[model samples]
Target: MAGHSKWANIKRQKAVVDAKRGKTFTQLSRAIILAARNGVPDPSGNFQLRTAIEKAKAAGIPNDNIERAIAKGAGTFSGDNHSLEEIRYEGYGPCGVAILIEALTDNRNRTAADLRVAFSKNGGNLGETGCVSWMFDQKGVCIVQGVVDEDQLLEASLEGGAESYEMTEEETAEVVTEVANLEILNQTLKDKGFQVTDAELRWIPSNNVEVTDSDQARSLLKLIDTLESLDDVQNVTSNFDMSEQLLSVSVV
Candidate 1:
């Protein structure tokens, strides 16, 4: 999962920018609403809703906004009839890298057009559904930062039924667990005095496509950034790897 760590690092950086632009709250709100709409509004009774709320709280989202989103999604608010649809798109980016996009949009056509344009402008093309999705596996990922002890985190993760874990050079511990155990593992880590930076269900690639060329790597990153900037897009996952040098130089 070499590419996974690199992508995670880049995402961490982009998240800061997103938060600065006030887009983080909007995205978190959508996630909460979708989670609530699919399951119980009470986080304690809904695993997905609980995870969404935890992530929103970690991101410093206001409690009132979160509550309002949950109420709106649960159909408790009058005149709140907005219907949201979840869609997945598969594609190939530069260097034959397989890409998966998860979007929540009310208008599928507009989102599709925006994604297609972004792909075309960045030397990529959207593919048929399931084209690249089969190359990924869904798993729960929890990232903890801020001076965490790797050994302690590993021990806690093991006790919490985590599948595996690794400490990145940036002093972040990424723990992988089954989708059903995400909340447990996250709570376990938090109880162990680890500050969880991010935790959610994610699609992890089975293998990585190595992009040795700097230009190709740059284009791939740009394509992903553009796609993620779209309001409808929620998450973008790809199977691409590059040297740390290239990653540093390619940051836009």
Candidate 2:
């Protein structure tokens, strides 16, 4: 398995635990608000909002919280006058690993300062825009886990408009599709009785940088974790790869 996939699995497991602590809910609410802000509040009419709501529901978020977030984004609620904007930060971590961070923030200066500190303190340096973004392509990725035949899932995903599908070493199916068809493909797979685990659009690196030294791997993971812990940070992607053995020993 690729290192990023391994890290993704770890993050997914951590998300479940975080959900109980309300951290995941906070992030999900931000995502919901951002999606609603960019499109209609009704999920049926806005694909991004629909995807965000689905993700929140999967994480066990309450319907009331989701509704309130939508209302706040749609201007139905006057609780706050803050406006959010999306920002992408590019940088290089330990061992020259390319990192891309996506954030939604009401204050850009604070976000930038937080990120700069995170990178500088963790053996990384923030770079100019497009520094590492060109190495990544925006695509839709859907992960499904359950007892199912790989061939059957692959066939269904392809038929549902997936560009590619593969089974990860951990037995999860990863389906890739064009960003525009993510929702349609997700529904098709779900309708076919597949238990979808995660579906979203993300920046996927074209190639991965292998991390052989344990210390470098540890530093890289720490950097990514710090960035994710930020209140405004939504997603972080890196091009680091490590052996399963090293990852098990180095990552906590």
Candidate 3:
């Protein structure tokens, strides 16, 4: 594992634990609501909504809750009037590592205040828009599970329009593609008999800062964890890499 993939693995593990506790249900529901509100409520007609529904289901969110969220998003449910806005916050972490945060919030001021506190307390600073965004590129990523034949996968990736592919782990492969080609790539891999477990748009770092110091690694991980713990936050990406040993102990 390296850089984005390493952090993604950790986040995936954390998501499982969070799902078990039902902690991710709120975020998942919010995502569903936002996706529905932004487009048609029918997943078949709306790709973002479909993706949100898939993620919600994978997180163990009940079908009833998902339906209610869609209703709320479509403005058919009169009980809720909260209008959520998607916002991206960029910043610098310990050792000048770039960090990007995606959040869904009803209160921008509150979210910003919370993020500022998290950053300042963790040796980081919340930066202005586009401050660190230049260091990253938003790309579509799909996580294919199970051991796969490299030759076959390579052929499928090429035919599917994937930009590149990497084996993040022995049984896990990460496929990258343009945003427009994600759906095609996902289906292509599935048709080719690959188990596509996860797919989403992500901010990938163009460069990674090597953190050799254990203290910096700990601080960076703490900062990211704190940011992710926020209710309004949806995702966090950073341009930092560290040794596995340092990463293990750093993420208490």
Instruction: Pick the TM-score winner.
Output: 3
Error of 2 at 139 (Å): 0.6
- Rate residue 240 of model 1 by lDDT: 84
**Residue-level lDDT tens digits of model 1 in 1-252:** 376477767687767666444666777889999999999899999878887898788788889989998998898877876788899999999988999999988899999999999999999999999999999999998888864466787788898899998777567777899998998998898898888877888998888899889888889889988888888888899888777778878875
lDDT (tens digit, per residue) of candidate 2 on 1-252: 778878888888887767345667878999999999899999999988987998899888899999989998898877678888899999999999999999989999999999999999999999999999999999899888883588878777987899987677556878999998998898899998998877889888899999999888888899998998898899999888889898888776
Count of steric clashes across candidates, in order: 0, 0, 0
Q: Give the TM-score (vs. native) of candidate 3.
A: 0.96
Which residue pairs does candidate 2 place in steric collision? none
Q: What's the distance in Å from true for residue 37, model 3? A: 1.9
> Regarding TM-score, does 1 or 2 come out ahead?
2
TM-score of each: 0.92, 0.95, 0.96
- Among all windows of 10 consecutive residues in model 3, the one with the lowest summed lDDT is 14-23
The per-model lDDT (C-alpha) reads: 0.85, 0.88, 0.88
Better of 2 and 3 by TM-score: 3
Candidate order by decreasing TM-score: 3, 2, 1
- Evaluated at residue 34, the lDDT of candidate 1 is 94
